[model samples]
Target: MNYRLLIQYDGTRYYGWQRQNSTDATIQGKIEVVLSRLEGRPVEIHGAGRTDAGVHALGQVANVHLTERPAEEIRNYLNRYLPEDIGIIEVKQVSERFHSRLNASEKVYVYRLATDPALHVFERKYMTPCEEPLDLGAMKEAAAYLVGEHDFQSFCTKKMKKSSVRKLEEIRLEQLLGEIRITYRGNGFLYNMVRILTGTLLEVGIGKLSPEDIPAILEAKERQKAGATAPAQGLCLKEVRY
Candidate 1:
């Protein structure tokens, strides 16, 4: 039977959601190992997206196919076998044609920044600490420039295989206390696009880049011309919409 799973994880210890050929552990590898042991057979989990190392997910979706077991019991059984950092939030029987990666229509990502000198040790795992004050208005203006369909090659890493054009549905900036949250909704993204976008917005907030420069950067389509890619720890896969 085919089963769909809603997953959440802390990416601190894993090498990402995908399995790689390294001694370093991965979230997928760990879960597969646990599930294999439970069912006495190999099991594969297909994720909707691939998050880089140290990146987290709050509502990631995955599909798995298993035989000889009831689909509804998969979540409860996996929870007992999987590690603490990775949890199966929900499970349901899905059509055999349902593919987690191909069926996704849109995704929402969030980047968090702490704009204060004092660091919260606990929050360090999930937020980027910016000791400088952020210009809220400037950040909002810069975000507006990113809300449209554009060639996002400048914001992505060069290692991607697909086209760089993407439809950005929304870009919003919010400041609460010392934390700044940047929420982005898009049809798709190239590698590291969210991180680079966050860095570019931070540059605008810090007076290093003008809001008008965003359009020009998009026109350039050269990764070197864009701002630096921020650390992956502050990024989260907020949701996936079908």
Candidate 2:
């Protein structure tokens, strides 16, 4: 049976979602180990997206083929065996063709910044601290150029080979008491794309880049043309939509 899983994890303790032989401390590696033991064979997990190390996920989705069992039982068993940081929120039988990555239609990521570093000391692990006050209006204006479909090679990993074209559906900025949240909804994202975009927008917020620079950055399609990739701790996969 193919089982679909809703997963949440704190990526701080592990590598990215994909399993690796180098380190067994990955979220996928740990879950696969437990599931493999349950079936008396090796198991593989297909994640909707692979987050960078130190990132977090609130609605990561994955699928695995397993022997028939109650979904709740599987969830409980995995939860009991897996580390406390990795959690299975839901598990259920899915279509044999249902795939977490290929079938995904949208992904939502949130990048949080503690604009007032002194205020969120304890929450530092979940957010990036920016002691400098940002120009919220400037950031918003710069974000406008980012909405809609575009080739994002400038905002992704420098060594990308696949097409960098992606449809970025939305870029919403919200300010809480002392935090700034940058939320991105897109059909998909290139490696390090969201973080790079955040850093570029932040540069605009700090007067380093004008909003007009966005068009040139996009046209250049050069990684150096964009700002630095933000720290992984500030990034979280908020949801995967089907």
Candidate 3:
């Protein structure tokens, strides 16, 4: 049976989601160790997406094939062996054909920014702190230009082999007490796409770039034309829809 898992993790100490032979300190590697021990055999798991180091996830999904174990028992057993920072929120049997990565229909990611000079002690690990004030209106205008389908080559790293064409369904920005949250809902994202876009928007908010420059930037299709990539700690995989 194929088991689907909803997982949450604080990625601060781990290397990343994908397992690496060079390092075993990864989310996937850690879980696989526990699962392999439970089943008395090697168990391979597939995740919905590979999140970078320092990136957090509240709704990460994965699928693993096991021999007819009770779902609740599997969840409880995994949780018992897993580290405190990683958790299996839900688990159930899925169809043989249901894949965690390929079957995903949409993904939502949120980048957080702390605008206040004095950083909140607890939020420092999760939010990027900005010393300068942001122009919210200008940032919104710039983000509007990125709402439709386009080749996001400018916003992605050059190390990617996949096509950069993607449809962005929504880009909503909300400001709370001392923090700024930018949420991205899209069919898919390229390598470091969301972080790069957030960095560009921050440039616009700080008068370094104008909202009118967004179209031309997109047209450039060059990574150099975009702003610097934001830090990974500020990014979080908020949701994945199948």
Candidate 4:
């Protein structure tokens, strides 16, 4: 039977979502160990996204084939044995054809920046502290340039043999109290793409780069032309829509 899992993890301590040969401290690795023990065979969890180290997920989805069993049993076993940072929010019997990654139609990622640290106490761990007071108007202008279909090779750090062209449908920047949440909705994103976009937007906010420079940067197709990749802690996989 194939089971679908709704997952949420802090990702502060783990290496990332994917299972690594080097360490068993990954989110997927830890969950697989417990499920493998319960089923008396090796179990694999296929996640929707491979988030980088220190990145988090609020509504991550995954699928795994397991022995015929109650979905609640699997969820209970995972939550009871999995580490405190990881939690199985929901589990359901799914079709064998369901694949979390391949079936995903849109991914929503949000980057949180603390405009003032003292005001945001509870969400500090998930947010990145930005001591500088950013120019909100400038940042929004810069974000506008990033929306739409574009080849975002300049925003990605990894060298991929496949195409880097992506359809970035929206970029919403919202400021609430002392935190600024920047949401990126797209068909897909490259590795570190959101973070790099955040960093480049910050540069525009701080007057390091102008909003008009966005076109040239995109046209460059060089990683060096973009801004630094923002810290991983600020990023969170908000949702995966099928």
Q: Which of the numbered candidates is closest to the native, going by highest TM-score?
A: 4
Task: Kindly list the per-residue Cα lDDT of model 2 for residues 1-242, writing each as its tens digit.
Answer: 99999999998888888888899988889999999999999899899998888889999999999999999999999999999999999998999999999999999999999988788888788999887989999999989999999999999886677788999899999999889999999999998899999999999999999998999999999999999899999999999999
Model 3 residue 199 lDDT score: 98
- lDDT value, residue 51 of candidate 1: 91
Residue pairs in collision within model 1? none
Model 3: per-residue lDDT, tens digit, 36-116? 999999999999999988899999999999989799999999999999999999999989999999999999999999887
- Global CA lDDT of candidate 4, please? 0.94
Model 2 stretches with alpha carbons more than 4 Å out: none
* lDDT for 187 (candidate 2): 100
Q: How far out, in Å, is residue 15 in model 1?
A: 1.1
What shift in Å separates residue 165 of candidate 1 from its native position after superposition? Answer: 0.8
lDDT of every predicted structure (CA atoms): 0.87, 0.93, 0.94, 0.94
Runs of candidate 3 exceeding 4 Å displacement: 117-119
* Candidate 2: C-alpha lDDT: 0.93
Per-candidate total of colliding backbone pairs? 0, 0, 0, 0
Candidate 3 whole-model C-alpha lDDT, 0 to 1: 0.94
Task: Give the TM-score comparing model 2 with the true structure, all chains together.
Answer: 0.97
* Residue 123 displacement in candidate 1 (angstroms): 2.7
